[model samples]
Target: MCFSMFRSKSKNSSIIQPGKFTPSNTNINPTALNSPSSRSHSQSKSRSNEFNSKSSSISSRASLSSLKDSLPENPHIYDLSEIRSATSNFLLRPFSSSSSSTSWKCLIDKKQLIVTQRKLRRPIDNSELRRKLSLLCKSHHASLVKLHGASVSGNYLYLVYEFICGANLSDCLRNPRNPNFTVLSNWISRVQIIAGIADGLDYMHNCAGFKNGFIHNHVKSSSIVICEEPALVAKICHFGTAQLCGEVPEAISGEDDDDSSNYHVLKRVGSAVGKFVGTRGYMSPEFQTTGIPTLKSDVFAFGVVLLELLSGEEPMKVHVDSGSGAFRKVSLIETAREAVGSGTGRLRQWVDRRLRDSYPVEVADGLARVALECVLEDPGRRPDMGRVAGWISKYYLESKTWAQNIGLPDEITVSFAPR
Candidate 1:
């Protein structure tokens, strides 16, 4: 059924044959169609198609390799030859901007490079750790951060990545008095960001490779970078503290706890010590009280991030009960509940004082629901990250669709803009 080409002679002239034409006896080699002086026209087309198929297969394999090699612990170390070929003799220069203990520069060839080599506080061999990271990197969707390429030399690693130049979500919330503060992020953006974070986590836990259960052990403001667009893109970063599930023994099956009160499951059962690990405010209640760490614990940390994004205040700093210092605060969720309100309605005072008249009630309420859901004490009660991502994406789609349908002004873009 494969139609091809041929040359025909009409009296004194030669032209391409015009009709359904397939090789009658099939003598075509199907590889040299590109040759300038192929004697048979029919053979040329067949050969061209064969070359295309082979090229496509090679492209697919290359893509698979790219996805496999970028894990943090097992970074795809690029051989000098490959890099030289990609960058046309490695004549690239460093980026000019430097901040936050890392120097970020774009290569002349348009590749982004991050340069930092903090002396490892502890030395460890983790090739297996890098493989687990590969699993996490490959499963990313819109909600998750993208991992590009990385290199290793002794204890130092050079992580080359897609450069996202945007301020962390905290800056906007912290400086409400600025002109840009007037265009302050709304509750909708918060919901979208929170939902995206949850989805990224869910993918790591359930749908990723057989051994991929990554608990982003650290989730905080500095870690999330918001993109410059509507429906804010929150990219999760800094996996230095991440724990890959399969590499270590699974003490209780991931499905061990159906009961919400079973904090005991979070306690480390084997040789691994489960002490005070992640960032303070974001740490789960179970992990804070008892040294138990689980996927739910990560969820709890995500909930704290969600609350901070929505309220425009650090979760731990929001509810001050007279005597307790800012750093020595109690449960963020409890304080957020009191600040946002109890049961029926929200408290106006609890809203970020800086938001002033800008924050809308509906958006705030929606974020509250997402934040509360993420922070629920029982792990079972919390929605999985996939479900969270779906809900967030649905909300985003619906908002855009509604605006389009009603002909509302599309003035809202998620990036930080001046009032």
Candidate 2:
């Protein structure tokens, strides 16, 4: 009996040894742990995990690249030396030269660009100038020419723009070589041009995200270009000229409080002091009197341009009185008003003879009325650009419907040669 108890105790001690493997204590298989097939399965799983890790890294990199591409390109600030080098140290012949500004079409960094030089009207610090430039460069629209960048050399601010191949609206309308012919010969083309200008102006006045309303101090036929390749599209130039040149006052910059009282104060102060600069005939009466460029002034100028589009004449013309042998200034606005006030037949007669009386007379009459409202002497009485754009859009649709009913072709080939 003693021997039997000792055997049972020795067996239990063997089963319960700390390092000994037992079926109930552990699930490891000795054969599976060392077999070639099991080793192959373990290696396969390790490779799968490694591949998944690499795939995750690749996916992460692709996502980062996509995000980088989505962001807007930052505006370039060109060095003065670079501008000088591009223009051959200011020896290159200017593309367009005027008393107030000069432009040069040159290659910069292998990209074609138009560099315009204008005298700075006021002194701005580097920080403020950079801020203004950043804002200007960020704003983009199909109807507005893009401002690539700008450079400052002493009192001159050199504005760089993407070189667009097109003719100015003034030259397209009134070619000196072909006085009787105009590129905007069709009624729909004229309507399209005015509608585009109205939309661009409305955007500048109300939808540009400007804290204060943007004022285009220069709104004239010469400031617009007509692109005729794929389609007839009008692009407004000198988009940020007023702001950069300090033609806009601090009160109108939206830097101060935005309120009617402040605006009234600005008008009074602007009228009371400061010399004004603007294209003749396009300037509103208030702008002429107060020397303050305002949103209403832009509207007045747009009205004049619209009338010019209708009449196919310059904004202001000198007519010699055959009877009196005296020169009289005949305003397009006056003629438009007279034509609309008289009757439909008078308006039909007043419409650009180039159209050959193809346009809808009623639509023309309504457009003339709208233009008159815009040119009203009182700034307060004139409609805002938003309303003007709305009217033009309505007229444009009407004109399109009229064209379709008449089976007029959309495209009309015309000479695009520069005057």
Candidate 3:
């Protein structure tokens, strides 16, 4: 499904260090990672070092050669002719978007690749864009799609990424045409997929390149893609909306409310007055009306994704079938909270029916509860990506789907199939 397009972790790799927290930052929004439980703190630190080493290894792979043969224009900027040549006269264009991104499947370095170009819809701070791009390029994690490089070509910014030959999570979860439609419905796969996503967010939030502030800003089912490497690796891909808020508090805490846990905030960096951005169903409520995005805001959107994953329903249009053929719209967040609030009784109402009740009700309830925490109106109350990752990893290791367990790889693009 190339948009003129385009492109996970699984049983074979651990992909997550259970109970460990990584510092979360990406001005797109910030999530806090609590200290690992005392008993496993040392183990968590060891794993963190391993992941940092891997990040350095992947960061070293950005080939300057790719930029050397630049499109006879600005070396930092790509020439339209070069882009056209790489894309075979622009043969694989997916669709056009004035504000949205237009992607293409391209042949580069003798391999299939995904190229995305976006024209700015609103004025974004130039320095913020630079900072975001720098961090974006440095970002390398097993659970995240590798960013090959990016170039400025006229008004549209061009980004190159490794192509994952598969469908996004939304399709795999419910698209009738997806081969994964069956496998993804199981509780094990569901938990693995969500856990894998949390790992990516954990990496982005707590890992390097975001000393400033950065948030995925865009966290949704469509942003998640699953690779069919038997391990069914899931990776987070889109970053067009990602922004870097200049400076923010590393950690904030208050004792006034029960939500006094130390949480990170994703505050506006450059200007207080900025347009709100993000998809409708995925945008955090505060960000929606006031146009402010924080790491907590991104958490809210991620919670929506989890809710969708659990119920197999869109957050905005969720509905239940009526005996008379009429239907009632069900608010995904509110409904999930209510279902989990009931102590797992009638929790079945929120679980996706496609599982046929084969999925574990208990785990389903856990996911709902986690999602409830994420979508809480007070961003401060939302659990940080670190906590979310730990929760998912706990369930992922406990889930029965995986046969072989391996650690997250230094280079996710490396083939993971056993010899």
Q: Best lDDT goes to which candidate?
A: 2
Model 3, 151-258: lDDT tens per residue? 554465677676776667777666666533444655666776788788778777777466533567768888787765555567787653454222222233223345
Task: Give residue 71's error in model 2 in angstroms.
Answer: 7.7
Q: How well does candidate 1 score on lDDT at residue 10?
A: 13
What candidate 3 gets wrong by more than 4 Å, as runs, is 1-77, 88-91, 95-99, 121-132, 176-181, 244-274, 318-329, 401-419
Candidate 2 lDDT (Cα, whole model)?
0.79
Clashes (N, CA, C under 3 Å) per candidate:
8, 0, 29
Q: Which ranges of candidate 2 are over 4 A from the true structure?
A: 1-72, 252-273, 411-419
Model 2, residue 47: distance off in Å is 14
Q: Give the TM-score of candidate 3.
A: 0.68
- lDDT against the true structure, per candidate, is 0.54, 0.79, 0.64
Q: For residues 1-419, what per-residue lDDT tens digits would candidate 2 score against the true structure?
A: 00000001111012554786665867778889688999999899899999999999999999999989754456677899999999998899988877899888899877788899998877776778789888877776667777788888889998888777778888888989889988798998898889888988888887777876678889998888887545567778888888888877666233225343223324332334566677878999988886778888888999998988888889888999999999999888988888998999889889889889899998999899999998999776788888889998899889989999999975555656545
Rank by lDDT, descending?
A: 2, 3, 1
- Candidate 2, residue 365: how far the Cα is off, in Å: 0.9
Which pairs of residues clash in candidate 1, taking residues 3 or more apart in a chain or in different chains? 73-130, 74-130, 95-105, 180-418, 229-414, 230-414, 266-292, 267-292
Model 1 lDDT on a 0 to 1 scale: 0.54
lDDT per residue as tens, model 1, 1-419: 00011111111112558898786786756567556566466577789889998999999899888867643333454443544444344344433222322434444245444432222323334575466446645554544545544544465444444455556556555655663462344544554556556666776666666443556665677666666544345566644334432212345554335543332243235544533444657776666776546666766777777777665666665445567554444565776778666642454555655555344455555566777887887666776555555665666555545455666443446545444
TM-score of each: 0.62, 0.80, 0.68
